[model samples]
Target: MTETVEPFTWHVAQDAIDDLHRRIDATRWPERETVDDWSQGVPLDALRDFVDHWRNHYDWRSTEAWINAQGLSTTTIDGVDIRFLHVRSAHENARPLLLTHGWPGSILEFRAAIPRLVDPEAHGGTAADAFHVVIPSLPGYGLSGKPTRHGWKVEKIAQAWGVLMARLGYAKWYAQGGDWGAAVTTQIGRQNVAGCAGIHLNMPIARPLPEDLAAPGPDELKALAALQHYQEWDAGYSKQQQTRPQTIGYSLVDSPVGLAGWIYEKMWAWTDNQGRAEDALSRDSMCDNLMLYWLTAAGASSARLYWESFASFAPAEITMPVGASVFPKEILPAPRKWAERHYTKLVHWGVLDKGGHFAAWEQPEVFVNELRKTFAAMD
Candidate 1:
């Protein structure tokens, strides 16, 4: 049977938007955090200001228009309908590249990175640097269909991505991702199936060995410190989602304010923002991401991915060619030696000075350049 792909357009019901406003207006206020800084989480004032802008000023229609412009399409793979932005390059030599986003993010995370990757000539690069970008909404995230059954782990998603690329006639392709996206992409390389040429990750997963623990270097020590900080201060959401997604599902699914607050804390913590998440990402863009969650009621479905795979996040040895760009502000920065231990065929390793977990969203130019270089090394 021939593959079917219909163009998708975005138009949220007006009633839903009105209801969102009513919910925001009726939000039961929480007491302000005692700390002036973000030590206790997104400060009350910051969240109130963000919620106010979203309720009163953010243009959901404009965001919908932008999504429609990105060449949206939908097709069912396995048992799920995946929504994606497929931007083919004008250049004939463009390589196929699949980009994925993690929790608290949708395909909108790559809004800035897409045009640059697909049309590098206009941006900065030559035809050889162009990519036919395939950015799919992960199962249970964004506009993709939520899995009705269990077992949609990262590895399963990796296999489904192979099917997606093959369905689109991409026998050979490159994969890139951050956060959970990285985990899935790593699994792609681990499976090494259906002509995956290479994989690139902004947040590569690699654990330290006993020897390294006994005698840590500067980079490894710093990475460990960041890991400690994340476990101690930034991992409450992870713990909750990995253990009981259904428990928090009630609040996240029912209350838009709850969903927004949950994601806003991540944006504040993960981005390379100097003081505030809005400093690095535009309020409009942030609201656009938030709306992806709200419109789809994806808060619980997205979190379920954690429950599926968080326990199996152990490092696996991969023989396929791999490259990684380690942003300085990554939640857990990987030392070159650690990456080399797993990605034995590690070809490109870039320790960037700026950017963070949301590499493409936070720094598009650098992110695109890193893609061009990393995949080129894979070539």
Candidate 2:
């Protein structure tokens, strides 16, 4: 018999928000180090302003209301109860598309893009292009129940997603993700699910080539140069999370400001629009994403995914048609040649005009446009 899953429950207790405020107020702050770039850390002044607003003015209830307004649903799959926002168009024959989020992120990442995907009419698109959207909080992230076991690696999570899609009765569907979501999509492609037609990803992992390895053409060499830069300068979080998640968890769990700073710095640095996190992302939006981690106590569990998959880097020689929209500011961009070695059915690849690691959150319009164009060609 097929497994039965329930709809999402949207509610956040007042005491939890209050507790967050209490912690922010009682935080035992550390001495600040001046004269350091963002590399040193989130600036003290920026962190303080965010905390003051979080405690004094930010509205958790309104965030909850906006979430409810989206009309999301929750479900249980493969013994892990999952929370997701499922949206479908009025057209009965719309295609199914599963959207997954990555670490330091929640389903909240797609808040702006969901409506456009679901009811394209509202966003100047036709019903023919609508998708039955399934945006799930990865296991141990957001409202999804924390994993009780140790083996929730990428492959295992992909299996769970398969069960989720089948439970929803989607015979054929597409998958898209960024960050770890990109990693998960690679696993889903590897699963070779009979009904998975094609996969779309903003983030694609390439196998590391030796520096002495014979170089490809100029384009490929440029891509390799970009990858090398990322490894050196942009990978500290990976090192910490993969080795000592618990140590970092202590500070993040105790202080909301600490968590915000931890996440905000990365967002500020990695986004497509450099040095414009405030203009690109509002303080409210940033706090809302952080609140998901804070309320769920998912700091360590989310980090552990890094530890488990740190070395399990599979450069998938993907047999299914794969499309990648590469953003310049993306932490790592696999060269088209290197990517070709892994994806046998690579059909679409574009160095996007703009955006960075968090494509949807940072450059939603560019991201949405790319999706429409690529999927249209395949359709």
Q: Name the candidate that leads on TM-score.
A: 1
**TM values, all candidates:** 0.98, 0.93
Q: In model 1, which runs have C-alpha deviations exceeding 4 angstroms?
A: 1-3
lDDT of 2 by residue, 349-373 (tens): 8787777788888777677666666
lDDT of 1 by residue, 46-126 (tens): 999999999988898977888888878888877789889888999867999999898888898899998899899899998
Against the true structure, candidate 1 has what lDDT?
0.89
Global lDDT of each candidate: 0.89, 0.78
Runs with alpha carbons beyond 4 Å of true place in candidate 2: 208-213, 216-222
